[model samples]
Target: MAATLRNLKIKTSTCKRIVKELHSYEKEVERESAKTADMKAKGADPYDLKQQENVLAESRMMIPDCHKRLEAALTDLKGTLVEIEEELNQKEGPEFEEAQKVITEVEQVLQSTEA
Candidate 1:
């Protein structure tokens, strides 16, 4: 029971952190893209534009990897939940609720990406 609760806490934190990381990566890509666009609009040097494009591309690449990590983390959480569902019913607490919330939030994130 203690182990299950600990797993729930850790998985919850992991999922939440992944969500934040994914959002940060997306914002970084957006910011870099805007910079690249602005540089083009300003007729920035070709070499500088290429470098900014590279940065933007790198940022864009991270997003897919982050999404994969998020999916894996969600799966891990779900598996943990399934392992302890009987225990969870007998020992519902804030940690369990938090885990459920994170699962829903991650699913929403995944759904939005699909759309």
Candidate 2:
């Protein structure tokens, strides 16, 4: 019957479409699996390795900026502290000596950490 043949043609077309979709899905999965295997073989810890590398790259880029900022701050702090200490020493006050000791310790700690 002609109606039967038409129904068969429709079913066949649907089957072909489904097969095409399945093949595409299979290829995508295989591609992902291969990529995963390659990464594993390279001993790449994708979790932090990628993120850490990105962070390191960004931090490296920021190093100059941060160094500039820290250097400026250290310079300003050192100059101010020295001026204050000089004034205090001239006056011979307990407050001046105490302040100098605290600022000096802080500067040392900051320098050590930066190093």
Candidate 3:
């Protein structure tokens, strides 16, 4: 039980870190897109435009893998929760509440990423 809880905590932490990375990558993509648009509007050189486009493409490619990792981490956390649900039900208190909170957070992050 202790090992399961520890593993859950580790997975939760990993998921949180991945989500943060996702947000950071998204922001970078947005910025790159805006820059590309601005450059196009200014009639920038084709070489420069291609460079910006390639960078944007690379960032877009990274997003799917990040999402996959986060999804896997969430699945692992959910599985862990299921495995311990009986124990959690028998013991009711702050630990239970904390576990519930973690579940809710993971669900919310998953939903947002899916959207």
Candidate 4:
């Protein structure tokens, strides 16, 4: 039981961290994309525009990578939840509830990304 709870906690932590990382990457990409667009609108030099586009591409790349990590973390969390669901049911509390919430949120993110 102790091991189960510990695993649950670790999985939840990983999910939460990956979620945050994904959000950070998404925001960075959005910001960089906006900057690139603004540069284009301003008739920025071709060389500078290419550099900005490269930066935007790098930021965009991080997002897909982050999504992959989040997907793995989500899978691990779901597996852990399934393994210990019965035990957690008897001990339902803030921790269990939080884990469920994380799962729901991550699922929504996954769906959005897929589209």
Candidate 5:
């Protein structure tokens, strides 16, 4: 039971990290888009515009990839938490049930965000 809880905790921490990284990636994409806009305003050449378009395409792909990673990580973390809850329920003791409820609530929020 202890080991299961520890694993869930680790997964949750990893999911948090994934979320943070994805947010950072989103900010970077926005910043690059702004830069491209500024370049256009400054009268960049057609070739430069094409290069900026390519960069935007790559950045757009990266945002979705990061979002996918975050969703996957959250799913894994939620699964681990559910498993830990089942184990605790079987044993029928202590604070695990309450902890499981909290985790479930968090999982619902994450799942909603993914949808």
Candidate 6:
């Protein structure tokens, strides 16, 4: 049970990293989109616009998959917390309390992402 909990902690950490990286990617996409629009308004070359369009298209495709993965990771984290709580016989110990705090934080992040 200890090992399983440790693994779940590691997974949760990784998921957090993934969420951070995806947010960075999203910011980059937004910058690129704005640049693309600026170039279009300035009558930039078709080749440049096409390249930017392709990048935006690719980002649009990947962002949803990233969201899905993040959601799955959050679900896994919640499930692991439940298992750990069950293993501990639902005792109100420090570990369970910490887990609940982490779960709440994760849920907040998930909610922000959805918004």
Q: What are the root-mean-square deviations of the candidates from the true structure over C-alphas?
A: 1.3, 32.1, 2.3, 1.9, 4.1, 2.5
Please, what are the lDDT tens digits per residue for candidate 5 over residues 12-106?
66766766676676677898899899889999998998899888888778766776776677677667766765767643333345445545654
In the range 6-68, model 3's lDDT, one tens digit per residue, is 766676677778878888888889999999999999999999999999999998888888888
Cα lDDT tens digits for candidate 6, 4-30: 667566766757776786787788789
Better of 1 and 3 by lDDT: 1
Which is superior by lDDT, 5 or 6? 6
Summing lDDT over every window of 10 consecutive residues in candidate 4, give the lowest-scoring window.
86-95
Best by TM-score: 1
Off by over 4 Å in 6: 90-102
Candidate 1 C-alpha lDDT tens digits along 55-111: 999998998999999999999998888778865564467987888889999999999
TM-score per candidate = 0.94, 0.35, 0.82, 0.88, 0.73, 0.80
| Cα TM-score of candidate 2 | 0.35
* RMSD value for candidate 2: 32.1
Query: lDDT per model, in order?
Result: 0.90, 0.48, 0.78, 0.85, 0.69, 0.74
Q: What would you estimate as the lDDT of candidate 5? A: 0.69
Worst 10 residues of 5 by lDDT: 90-99
Candidate 1 has an lDDT of 0.90
Model 4 RMSD in Å is 1.9
The number of the candidate with the highest lDDT is 1
